[model samples]
Target: MAFEELGRFGVWRPFGGFGSEDARELEALGYGTLWLGSSPPGDLVAAEELLAATETITVASSIVNIWSEPAAKVAESFHRIEARFPGRFLLGIGAGHPEIAAAYKKPYDALVEYLDALDEAGVPAEARALAALGPRVLKLAERRSAGALPYLVPAAHTASAREILGDKALLATEHKVVLDADPARARATARPRVDFYLGLQNYTANLRKFGFTDEDLTKPGSDHFYDELVAHGDATAVVDHLAGHLRAGADHVALQVLDDDGQATLRALAPLLREVA
Candidate 1:
């Protein structure tokens, strides 16, 4: 249940052939956790595989959707993983977006109800986190789970989230990174990955709160927006940018690289990550 168990830095990637394999390597590089993002299995199948891969690093789901995954089933899956891995699994759950929700009513109410179900199903509050962005949800995260996992947000949002969460709960933010020397190509790599997110109200509204203009949020996202959110350039520059999130408020920054070969990308940054550690 302790946040430190999750580590100070981690890698957040979609399920891939090298997921567990790369997880072992990241562990050696001094990373504390490996997060499987972009909605994972309702059974938490990946969590078991991840924990089995490394001896110490915590394995977390960036989110399991509340609208789709039943709390009882999810809790059961958590127990299954924890039984084998013990304290190495973190269950991050979210209400998801309106577009994906079958019946998106009061999302806050749904999230609360979901948490209540987890509480009844024997899921410990310290083992889970809410993918919250707004104030209401941030407050809910403070009370219900370990802390908040805000994705596609700037350092300002992390500062605000930390203020709302206070000092006790964990504040793990996802920082998208592109380690490329070429500005055009680096931004090109990041834009496509986040374009769909801009369409999602939760992400866009959060961006607006940080003072992003309407123009900055358009189709491909403006240069200013890219520079504001993504950590690009060489390995040192990217590491420095990621450090800014920690300086702002993040307890941990889950690095999400915008590259086809995630394993290779991380390999290149091993030295930089070591310096951070």
Candidate 2:
């Protein structure tokens, strides 16, 4: 239940954003983990590269979509990574969206089956986590895996999830950050990202549970909705917003900086990482 390995602050980026140099840089900057987003392949070559590039930072899949990646294959990838990198790898699995996956159906049940396969394949429960959102899946994550990696949520949801996960389970929340002082400019960069997810039912349903109105979820999203999901402002303010998740009972916060190449933001936040850590 203790995910002390991942530490407090982690970086979340797509495959293109994270490379050998980037991994080394983030590691040097004191980031405890690097999450490979966008449903990384079952083979996990990208994870291996990052693991080999850095000496200590944990590398995790934001999620290997259960609908796309066979549980057995992912379990195999887990073993391969663990064998080479040891405790530096964490497998993050999820059902993804119904619209995107042709095989998506009874997602909760599919997740249960996938976990069973992983268990059969000898992947330790502590070695993986789930991209959980709802109460049911959150409970599943607590019972079956290391913890929950809920995405695009506010600190309030972290508090709610911690109540469900209790004191033992690892609760890592993924929060977007825009390191821009201008509110308009920040929201301009964040709106498209929010809009894309608004088209996905799972994300919208989760947002609604936290009191987001139908109006708030409409295309382009409301200003309040964007502000709640994405922390914007200077480095100090962004770090403070991310810390809300930790204060809300989250053990870790994976920050996804919105902009071209998150290097500048990461560099700017290097000194401030300890505040959130």
Candidate 3:
């Protein structure tokens, strides 16, 4: 139940985005974990490569879409990585969007079944996390897995999620960052990614729960919405905003730099965040 390995903040990147050098640099910068986003394959080779590259710092999947991956196979990968790297990797799984997934149905039930499979395969709950957004799945994460790792969420959602998961479960929320000082430029940078998530029902539903209306979730999204979800501005401002999640009750915040390759943003924020961490 101890998530000290995850530390105070982690880097969130797309699959195949980081090389061995990037992994080492992030470890050197004092980031506690590196999370691979965009539903990596069940083999988890990317995770293995990163873990192999770095001496410490946990590497995790932001999520592996359960709709596209078989639970048993993913569990096998978990055991493999755990055997080699031990506590250095965490498995994060989700049901994904129904619009894109043809087989998506009864997601909550499917997740229950999937966890059952992992359990049968001997993958311990504490070693895995769920890509949970709403009350139901968040509760399930609290009961069945290590905790919830919700993406594209604001600190308000983190606070609510903390209420649901209580104090013990790992609450690692992924918030995007655009390190531009100009509000206009920052919002522009965040729009495409925010718009992409808006098209998905799950994200919209979760946003609505946090008081984002149709206008706020509309194309281009509102400035307030952008500010809430994507931390922008100078490194100090960005670090302060990310710290909001910790204050709101998250154990860790996963930083997904929107425009940069993640290196510059991480390097810039590392010093300021070290004290916070």
Candidate 4:
């Protein structure tokens, strides 16, 4: 009924750039987990460093790309991290975008093979989650991994993913928060990122199902769409956005504070985010 390991909320930050000290600060701030969303090297060596730095905060990959990092190698890394950190490490994997991978096949099938390899290589199912955005993959996540980790989605999508994942699997949603109250400035900061995502078919397809129109899905995205997706404002506004996920049946919400990142921002926002608990 709960992802006690991941806790109720966590911070989603770049895995490679920040170090153990940054992780320690987030732990001190009361964030339950440190989700590594930015792509790190295939070895997951950075994750181990973060684990060594903190006693209680969990460290998870919002995703490690299955395309770039082979399952066998990732599986080996998984085993090593698990051996050192045990339950504190969670391996998150994704099929990635066709534009990103030259050999992007039927992603669902590719993901199936990846999971199979992980199974054979001693990567436990409970220690992993899939960055799934659709029904087919969401079902696979429920059956094979811990659960679904949907990104760049709204509370509506979280509700849908929960239905697809049912009660057993964890529904950990990745939500972005910009620490600015100005609507125009916030959307401006978020638009370029949204434009890049618009090029990805997987993200666009999922957002469409969530009721975003073609015009809304256009480059830079409509202001309404951007505003709905990014929780742009002060810490209080961001907490309200994170709560929407919990209310929509999300077991955990990965707090991805956009643009203004690093240890200082986490420290500044910690008190505000912890109040939500």
Ranking by lDDT: 3, 2, 1, 4
Best by lDDT: 3
lDDT of 2 by residue, 130-183 (tens): 999999999999999999999989888999999999899999989998899999
Residue pairs with colliding backbones in model 3 are: none
lDDT of 3 by residue, 1-277 (tens): 3699899999998888888998899999999999999889999999999898889889999899999889989999999999999889989999999989999899999999999999999999999999999999999999999999999898889999999999899999998999889989999988877678878899998899889999998877888889898999998899999999999999999999988456987888899999999
The alpha-carbon deviation from the true structure for residue 97 of candidate 4, after best TM-score superposition, in angstroms, is: 0.5
Q: Candidate 2 has what TM-score?
A: 0.98
Better of 3 and 4 by lDDT: 3
Ten residues in a row with the worst lDDT in model 1? 14-23
Q: Write the per-residue lDDT of candidate 4 for residues 100-181, one digit (tens) a residue.
A: 8898889898999999999999888998999999889999999998999999999999999999999889999988777778
TM-scores for candidates 1 onward, in order: 0.96, 0.98, 0.98, 0.94
Q: State the local distance difference test value for candidate 2.
A: 0.90
Model 3, runs deviating above 4 Å: none
lDDT by residue (tens digit), candidate 1, 1-277 = 7888877788888744336667788898888888888778779888888788789988899899888889999999999998888899989999789877877789999999999999999999999999989999999999999999999998998899999999898999999889898988989999988788878888888899899999988878899899988899998898988988888889999989887776777888878877775
